[model samples]
Target chain A: MIMTVTLTILCLLLILCFVTTSIIPTPVGACASLIGGFLLLSFIYGFLGAHFAAVIQIIVYAGAIMVVFVFVVMLLNVPTQDLPKVKISLADILSILLSIPVLILVSIKILNWQAPMIDSQNVEMKDIARKMFIDYLWPFELISFLLLTALVAAITVAHKNKGSRYMLKEGSDHGR
Target chain B: MTIIFSIIVFAMVLIVGFHVAPLMTWVERRQCAFIQRRVGPNRVGIFGFTLFGLGQPIADAVKLLFKEDGNPSYVQPFFYFIAPLIPSVTGLAALMVIPFGAQDTFFGTVFSPQVLSVGAGFLLFFAMSSMSVYGVTLAGWSSNNKYSLLGGLRASAQMISYELGMGLSLIPIVLIYQTLDLQQIVYAQSHSYLFGFLPDWGIFRAPVSFFIFLITIFAETNRLPFDLAEGEAELIAGFLVEYGGMRWSLFFLGEYAMMFAFSGLISCLFLGGYSLPYLTHESLIHIVQPILGSFGSIAVFLIEFATLIVKMSIIMLIFVQVRFTVPRFRYDQLMKLGWVTILPLALINLFVTALVLGYSSFK
Candidate 1:
């Protein structure tokens, strides 16, 4: 009962963080909240016996990947451009009104859902490596190849540079 | 009951962490002074009795706490306020997971010295340490100062870059030890020497990992040579340009505390953690049991804890010595060091370790 209550609170906090991320006007604040949400999600994964997944989530997502995300956002200095008026519009209200029944249905499903039995209660790093490399080896290799192609494509597109544009005025701040 | 034990142990760790912040200030100052061939701050003391400047940090703390917390009207209220928190909170949180001493019974409630002990508890340090990026970035972004933002981003960027190499370096150790449990890794080191001279420590087993981890710690902690973030000369204290008084001090305190924690971590991972060079815990307990009698367990626990602290302090002193000696890395140099140099070397080290391990096992 206590464990259930704790997980419930964690899930609620996770939702709160995501909501905060979307609602916050500043880019940095949004990014921070997103990191929090990811951490909470990782914690929930940990509670669900995905120990390898939990730590990797923090290390890869919140740690390395999001740092790069924040770096790009900061480098671009887009918070000024992005900080539009955060008012609920007719489109937002209409979307919400349209989604109410779906939301309720989803909530009902979530509430009624039972957690699956975790066969491996103590999932170690080796078990994860085995599953990824040996069990689902083709999928893993295919995914890596796909990611490599994406990276190559991204570089190809980036290198084409129709015209390089500057965000901040030349005299504003010299980061370099 | 388990929860209660965890809470108590956690609180103890917090106290140690909290105290470490101020103590490190003294260590840095005194050690730097010693390196420079001068008597540093041998003045502040209780009732005018300067105890070799032991009271200096306390005096500094009092002054900082009382000074005006210059909360500028222009800064983003929430991020500015919460920015200092992430570093300190993450440092303390990381401390909770670190195994300071062996398990001991206190009032019949036997508990591990650490709060949380998982299969891969060691990685939790990186996980917590990694979150400190937000603290720097948030401080920069919310401060409404371009220079602060640049500084913050630079610092955060350095941390992120170094973290990759640091995490990669540990793979070899994990391969050699064959467990992610930090306690198990430490226990694995306690067996005996490899040959007749070499000790069975992580450093001996994986010298490349040790070197990589050392360099990355310097980068991760934002210490000198790698401390371009607060380039006292260039960025005017970096992301901390807008901060003052207690707020400014909190950043340093957090850094120092994290440094101490990392020292503890390095000792655990590389050095013979909480164990004598040659003696195991059982032997140590056996040796001391005759002298202390019924207080054997408690005595051993204190000794282990002290051993860990002593090892950490040695690292802390090295930090101070290096800070005073080395010149700060140029921004490009720092980036190059992390990426062009350390990252590839770590990868090579990882692959070599795996190949060696596989070959040895197969043979």
Candidate 2:
């Protein structure tokens, strides 16, 4: 109940702020408001007692991310001329129409997730930890290594290609 | 009754949180001023101008309240907003697992204010805190600004690097206690190495864990020297560059709240929490509980809460002091410290702790 109230209040405030200050409003303002709404929703989720999921949501969605999109946008600098002109051919229209049933089916499956057992609660913290560390340790280590590799790749990408058009002749030919 | 009690506890905690957070700000300003040979907020509250600057924090709050909340043009709208909520929510959630004191049965009901008392509660808290990095990272990225992006990248690398060392470092304490319930861990520390009089803190029993834990605590909370995320001089408030008004305030609250939680965890697990010098459990009840009535059982409860606050304040003071005392670590050096130095040391600590615990159990 408290979490719900908090989320409602936060969302309303965020929306009010965005609408008021987004004087030279761009699509970005709307998108940001939507994201903020979800973030507050997750906080509500945390407050409602899904501690593990809430933290995971925060760390993955809010903490280390959202910036990737920003960086991509900045690098792309989507000018009016650069905007990809969509022809909206018949095939695209047909595909969009065909995807409606698939979306509905997915939503139905999601709504039927096993009924949350609010009363039958016996999941011990030690049991969860033992399983997580001992049984899942190998997979966990592998995932972390993968994340590290991703981090390295991201850093490399960010560093490379600065003034690359000129360096192409000097560096690319040598490397090739 | 349970619901009502939980509400009361929640309200008390919120009040305490709000009160302590601004006080910390005052402490930081006054200390910084002292170091620089300047008088701090002395002109505001009680003395100089008679307002005690007691109203400074309030004034700041009002300003934030009235400020025109602005969103940057380049930000990924969705992620930008989610950023602050992530850290703040995770921080508060982490506290659910922390035990306040020992539990006692009263009138056929087990009444313990220590929220969620599970066996692996300590690990759960650590995991929640580890996940808090996302808030800063996402905010930095979503801002669609260079300064913020750099801050986000740095925070990710720093947080992840330190996380490995921090997790490995805490294993030794787990080995010694052989339990994840924080209350049990504190109970284990009530006795001395030689006898009953001396304290049996984790620092004494497992010094390696103590050292690694301390280092990791600094990194985990993004305190001075480790505060690469908001290297204000360099990053311009880091990930929070684009945030304004109340949204910005949430992030600030989250950071301070995390600091308090980290200190509390450290105190509870390793520093004997509220365990007093030369005082037996029996004596505790006799001296303290009488005035409070059956609420005396709640004596340890209050002590645990106060001890946590005091310990956290001391740590925060140190954090502020260090911010003035030392220069910030270069980003690469920070990484090296976590991965190369702290990680290896943590592993060694774990092994040694395991060996000691094994021997003790067998004996």
Candidate 3:
């Protein structure tokens, strides 16, 4: 009962933060909301017995990825004057018009949905690890290697001064 | 023993962790002064007889409390307000997972001395520490200063880059221990002997990883050598230029606190945390149980806690001394070290560790 109440409050707060982020549309504020949303979601995950998942969510998405987002946003240094004016797109109107029945249907489904009891105390993190590492090992390694290659490629592309005198020469220490 | 008792224990641990911040301020200043051949903070004390300036932190606290905290109109109110709290909160929250004592039974219930002994363990600490980047980034962006924003971005980028190497370095330790639980790792270290002689601490097992982790932590905490973002000469205190009084000091407090937490973690992982060499908990209990009777385990717990604190302090001392000993890294040099040097070194080390482990297991 207590867990339910706490999760309810947290979820509500997350929605509130998302709303605030949308309303403000300030880049830094939006970034902060993004982080805040991650934290709340992590907490909700923790309550739902996905402890490792919760921590990884924070570490990878909120901590690592959002940091890059914030970095780009900061680098861009967009002034408030340049912020996109709020406009009610026809697509938005159509989406809202299309969402009423879907929302009601989803609500009905959720109303009847039975959440599995998450015995946080008993959930075995080892199970998740074994599934990922032992069972799905190749896919995991492939994804990781793919990401690493992508990172290298991105860095290569981002070398702003490719042929400058200060260019870190290939196959050298850059005269360290 | 019970939920209520556990909460009380957690509060006690938290209080102790909080004290580390102010205490570190004193330690850093005194160490810096000694290194530079100057007397540091010897004035503030009872009856004007300075007790090696032990009262300095108290005085500094009082001054900060009284100092006018400016709320500049130029800065964004919400982000600026929220930013300072993140580092300290995250630092202290991360500290909660580290076990300081034994999982001894005392009233038919087993109790280990940590605020939370989650399975994620030190990974959770990394999670919290990673979020600390937001504090710097938000502080810079919110302060409405270009220099601050640049500093914040650079510092956070350094932090993120170093984080990859740091995570890679720890894989060897996890492989050796076969557990992510910090308590189990600490226990394993206490008992596992390397070559039937040396205590199986990470230092002996994975020296390369240890060195890599140490360097990354310095970068992570934004300390000297990796502290080009906070370089005084160029950007003039960088992101911190706009912050003042308690607000400014909170960031410092958070840094020091994280430094303290990291020191404890390093000690726990690399040194036999809370367990003295040749004096495992079992041995201690056996030796003291008869003499002290039922209180022996409790006594041992206290001793272990003290031992952990001592180890943590030693690491903190190293953290302080390094600040004065090392010169600052240039921005490009820092990046090269993190990516070109440390990342490759970490990957190679991990490969070597895996090979060695596999070979030994086969034997």
Candidate 4:
């Protein structure tokens, strides 16, 4: 009940912000202010410091990033009816029911597990790096390579049609 | 007293958060105009201070308050609302570790100026910064907009790429000080830089480390030259494209607060937190006590706070100037600088610092 009340209040605050901005003036300030507040909250709680989270939030969420989304929406002109539909199958529902017990068991195990031996704050960068490079090195390297391959593949896909342009130029000489 | 201090700090943060964004807007215009040798905002106040058209920010606030805060019916309303909160909180909370002054005394009880003085403060700071990426990612996904989704993916990739180098760059400093506690690191700098006169600061002992650290800070903070995540001409505000109104303000507050926190960290780490040159803290404490009587501590507190603020302000000024001076990097170039240039140099510095420490320890 308390959680519900808190969530409702949060929703109301968002609504109040939404209504006030929509009713009176320019969208830029309203949007910037609203998003800016959320970004700060995440920075403090989501990460550890306001500095790291806040910078990432602003640049990715408010700065150049949001422009892309807005432009696409404007350009593509997605109408109200064109939205994609999702179908929740009966099998999926049954699988969810089956998974609840497993999830509860996992949570119980985690709850009973020993807390970290070392002071959480005292965990050094070297310890973190040692764990990353020694224990998780294979997975780390695999992910790096995967990312590289994905980048190359994206470029290849984007350029696939352009290859025909160069071949057409060569064919023009044969015709001549 | 802790409660009182906490309330005061919260109020100050709120005021600072509100004022900084508009102040930044003014600074941007004036700096841009100055570079082009044109007058800017001469009509808003006396002596043409125009409060630098300070009213413009107020005008902007009023304008945003009335605009239509629209969201598509298809968008997930819950996630859309929650997304911006993450970044804002993360940004504001980082101020906890920053010691704005040397110390604070409350009702004759001496207390450290910092809110949270944990021994492993720096690690805690990095962890917080890391968690803010979720806000960007969620905002993009929740919007159900293609452009937002793409922007979110790019941001996550960019943040992860730079984060590795950012974390690595600080290793030399930690090794040199033989400590991860920011306060301890600052205290360690109390030694002489040149046998007696120069105050030993991070920059003096490890110039290369300092240079790399400064650059990494710029990349980490996503300030111009390194601001690819928000490359407006290309991405149009990237991941936040769907956000508006007060939600938007939250993101703005987060950014400025983060900037403040970063400058404070740089001050604490490299510049020597509240430590003055050629003056022993003990001597000063001894000399000041007689003149002010019971209020001597308050006088000392004021001096330390002023000194810190001045140092931090100078650093912030440098950031603003750099913002105006530098050109943005291409996405590939930014990646290359982080992985190829920064990472290798950071590793070399770490090895060198470790070897030096080892040699000194044995000798």
The candidate that wins on DockQ is 3
Tell me how far candidate 1 lies from the true structure as C-alpha RMSD in angstroms: 2.9
Candidate 4, A1-176: lDDT as tens digits: 55445544554565565565444233333444455455444433223323333444555454334444433333333343454554679997999899999989987985575422333344455565787899999999999999999999998887788647565465233211
In candidate 4, what are the lDDT values of residues B69-91, reduced to their tens digit? 87678776766888788777776
* lDDT at residue B189 of model 3 (Cα atoms): 84
Q: Candidate 1 chain B: minimum summed lDDT over ten consecutive residues — where?
A: B190-199
Question: Which ranges in model 2 have alpha carbons more than 4 Å from their true place?
Answer: A1-176, B46-53, B105-109, B278-283, B289-295, B298-300
- Cα deviation of B28, candidate 4, in Å: 2.6
Tens-digit lDDT track of model 3 for B1-363: 378768877897779867887888998889899999999887789887788999999988899989998888999888888888888888888788778887887756777788787767788889989988788888887888867877888888998899999999999999988888888888888875756688878888889988999999999999997887778877788888789888898898788778878887898888878888756688889998999888887888889999998998898888888899999988999999999999999999999999999999999
Q: How much lDDT does each candidate structure score?
A: 0.85, 0.69, 0.84, 0.67
The alpha-carbon lDDT assigned to residue B163 of candidate 1 equals 89
**Candidate fnat values, all:** 0.53, 0.10, 0.80, 0.03
Candidate 1 residue B352 C-alpha distance from true site, Å:
1.7
Arranged by DockQ, best first:
3, 1, 2, 4
Which tens-of-lDDT digit does each residue in A47-124 have in candidate 2?
Answer: 445554554554555433443433344333343344445476999899989999998998798556432322213444
Q: Ten consecutive residues with minimal summed lDDT in candidate 2 chain B? A: B43-52
For all predictions, the C-alpha RMSD in Å is 2.9, 7.3, 5.0, 9.7
Model 1 lDDT tens row, B75-126: 8899899999889988888877768777767657786887878756688888
Q: TM-score of A-chain in each prediction? A: 0.76, 0.50, 0.72, 0.39
Q: Tell me the RMSD of model 3 versus the true structure.
A: 5.0
